[model samples]
Target chain A: MATGVTATAGTTRGRSRLRAALRVTAAVFGAYAFAWGIAAFGSALGALAGLAPAEAVTAASLLALLVLPVAALWAFAVPRAVMGWVLLGGGGALMTGVACAVRMALP
Target chain B: MSRVGGPNRGTPRKGKLISPALRAAMLWPHTWAGVTLGGLLMLVFFMGSLAVFAQEIDRWMMPATRVEAAGVPISLDHLSLDRAVRPVVERLAAGRAVRDWYVQLPEPRRPVMALRVRTDQGNAGGMATVDGTLLPPVGTLGASSFFYPLHYSLHLRAGFVGYWIVSFASVAMLVGLISGVIIHARIFKDFFTFRSWGQVRRSLLDLHNLTGVLVLPFHLMITVTGIVIILPIVLPAGVQTLYGGDIDRFYTDALGGYERPRTGIPAPLAPLDPMVAEARRLWGGGEPAVIFVHNAGDAASYVRINRDTGDRISLDVEPVYFDGVTGALLQHRRPGPMVATHRVLSGLHFAAFEHWPLRWLYFLFGLSGCVLIGTGMLHWMEKRRVAHGVRPGVGWRTVAAATCGTTTGLLIATLAMMLANRLLPAAVPSRELVEVAVFFLSWIGAGLHAGVRTVGNPPWSGQCTAVAGLAAACVLLNWITTGEHPVRALAGGDWAILGVDGVLALTALASWRVARRLAHRPMRMVAPTNAEVSDHA
Candidate 1:
């Protein structure tokens, strides 16, 4: 309801221009943090799953590298820039936490 | 809006799901990103496609290399390896250190045996026949060393700034591609949409979208893999953290974990035949392409034998090692999973380990990527061309000229380099430098021509005509200079030259067709009416 109201408050062009700028800014951070976090989480998960450390690190890094474009898509497709960033941060944190917990618990 | 609201009909009403506002929001970034970096991406894709045939281009450039390649069997008995290694030894003896030199033996892939010497003085070496007879200087840096570097380094004027620029453009392309998909209402259904004879801007937009979607996955993978390959230089944190900042150690680990130390003791180098025999024996069957003697003539000298690629999809050429003094084998272990994965990703980007069929496929897809960028740029410029009042503003005019310069100008520049290669005397000092100069100079000329050409009279068709003529001239000059034109090259079973010339002829024909289309377009750029404005919107 608030999104609809704020969206209607301003002129269409002005609101959209501001939103577009924010989207691009948020996306750059989302892409970087997501890329780094995914690699870390992947390696942790792989190590816990009994894969060789080198193999796990490599496979995880490579697969995570592919998520950059999709992450960009997610940034744009969301209803707002803040929501997109929140999702990126939340997902990255969860993955990193799970990966860390798995390493600590198993070892 | 003609083909909307079907696939996007999820959240109750169409407006609720993907509102008109959302579509416009996506379009803003998509258009800007795609337009701004489109030209550079076209260059990257175009040169990258050409680089796939780098070895083939080397053979075409140096016609003497056509008969023997690095892959074919050659008699090492008459190879006279000592004579080839003498110059580097002499250079080192003179006190100025010889940087690096290796015996690139004659094989079917790169037939001539090149001593490939590099000292502080520069390339003071030449190619040799199988019997060690000196072949004349090959003149031009094969498109591999010259034109192909443009793909990554773009001339090194600012020292690898080109690579970083390309990397950034690729990221923009990634973001733009994703936004394009989000904004697009019909993706799979509009896969085959190309209305060539329809209203001009509509036709171009449709064509751009079609090519963008057609090779979408390939473009994505290629862009991603390119970024991955450059990550070492771009984001060094991974290596810094992992290896504790020792790059050399990281390389050693990646290369199956072996590094030899040089001991200063005068010793005669062992004959390479025994090491070659041992490597062949160990590997079942494969010819050695490179015979690298490290710390040559030193007590700690070791020889590494690298196998040429054949019928494999890997960039990791497992090297076989041997003691240079004793000719006894010294083995290295296979690569770890991390290294192996890196090699595969790089191999996919380089596309080196493939036969001609796969190379052609990569080339075709790469050209399609160029088309996607070119068509997208045209769509944007076409709208601006019509929307303008009197003569259009400076911004629109600059973009108009830039569009022609990058598209047709790049073609002109590439062909001009090949022409310089043929015409420039090999004995002329810095012959390769002259050829590269011709390349950049011609590109500048094309840009100037496009900039001065009047509005409403686009410079495309004229520039394209020049491109066609220059391309045809390149084919002809090869015959005049080398006596190895496409017809005779084909007759002599020299497919390398044949393929190069054949592609040039086809490009000429295609350019001419483009020119003809541009020549026939009406004076005024077609104005999009209120009805069709929604199409772009």
Candidate 2:
């Protein structure tokens, strides 16, 4: 019985590995798009106010919260979409970088 | 030991079975190793996690101690070496029992001239004004700061015993983590798959394995770094052998050179302002946090400025020692690569340089590490239950009960301590004792509840309830004691206290939901009759 279970589990693993690869690729692409969107929005906010670079970046973080709902909706509508995972990962990274850069450059 | 090809070797009983000898050999070590040290590990991890925010917690707990005045650069012109040295030296000489004297100048957000006078009888240190007026001792119970010291050096036996115990636990944790990872080969596949409804035993095993795998990196890093943080203590024999047993020389070479000793004869000292100015200039404009003046009135009276820029984890600043009379730069200790690396590692482990975002990340990772350990313990219990063929024996049950009690119970106990800090009278003698009382009492309560309730229902639900209840108590206690509503505190820009309260509230809500789910879980009845077991087999 244990041997049969092991054999079945091995086959399932091989199938899942392929699926996981596809999922990862989608996650990465979605992350990039989300990060790019955030960076662009932050730059726009920096231009709008005469605030220091850091302040502008902080303001941009506030704006990024709005995209959370969109991300949530995306997660709901397409539960396993590679795009949603990517967006979350990429957006977080982008915002962190922008915030750090602004902090160093501004004051 | 049983021989190969023995009847018991290949036998498949109703439930998993091993010979008495095999069971004793395998189960005894596993059980004893876990049971003896599990409570200690939970304490270390939990306290260390809280210690990550020691400074912020200090700030929140002792609001009255908050330094309102910003530090001003000490002017070189106004510095009178004779003036500063005469007062401190005279005081020390009069006491005649003084071992060491440390003078600390003002810093931003904690502007107070501090002096530490070390005597044969422990050490006495407190804040003072620039003009040398000693302030009343601050009485607020610093929960975060208290936990910080307690974590690495369990507030017992002058920190030596604590260090050894913590070091041993760290090594054990590392072993457990590696062994656990190896045993569960399908680690990644089970990530994020927590099925709460299934065979109760199988579901628990799955949940434990999944959570452990997900947070394995955090557990590994924390365990390894915790050992590294105390590496000097654990590996002192090696250092002793290599450095010819000159611990002082080893420290100086490994860390930085200790300031040259002073001539006992009185002499003028250099003003601190120039030293502070030079430090700021070198560090590119950050506030000099601590000013250490050595050899107070002698020719060797040198001032070293430690800048607190809050930029990097490495607190290394150029040390400028001067001739007391001439104010000439004597020696500057710029750390080499090894020393700088050590400082950086210490800073990272302590989270001293973290801001809000990074601190939150540490908190999340710490919580995940806790969950990882917890799940691993639970999984071990489930596996034992399945293998034992009967309900686990008294010893196994005790360990299972303790695992639930200590991990989740300590969290609640910490919350209870925080609440005690506020409700207990500020003027209460031995306030620390009061805090400890609350901590232990809450822990004992959880332990008793776990021991009693575990027989009827799954232990996880009771553990969850304990955590939720404690967390809720913390939030409510804060409101009750401080009279600072969460919204009002947030509005007032007192986010440190507010954030802690809010996070505790969220933790309670989440745990409560988990508890509710676990409470409804159906109980399993294992067959007591040997005939029934044979039939199943």
* Winner by DockQ: 1
lDDT of each: 0.71, 0.57
Best by lDDT: 1
Single out the weakest 10-residue window by summed lDDT for candidate 1 chain B: B1-10
Residue B361 accuracy (lDDT) in model 2:
75
Query: Tens digit of lDDT per residue, candidate 2, span A1-107?
Result: 01122334666656544444433343333433453346344644463446432233333333432343234323212323355465566665665465445434532
Question: C-alpha displacement of B119 in model 1, angstroms?
Answer: 5.2
Per-candidate fnat, comma-separated: 0.16, 0.00
lDDT (Cα, tens digit) per residue for candidate 2, span B394-458: 76678777887777777777777776776777788877677777788988988887788666334
Best by TM-score: 1
TM-score of 1: 0.85
DockQ of 2: 0.01
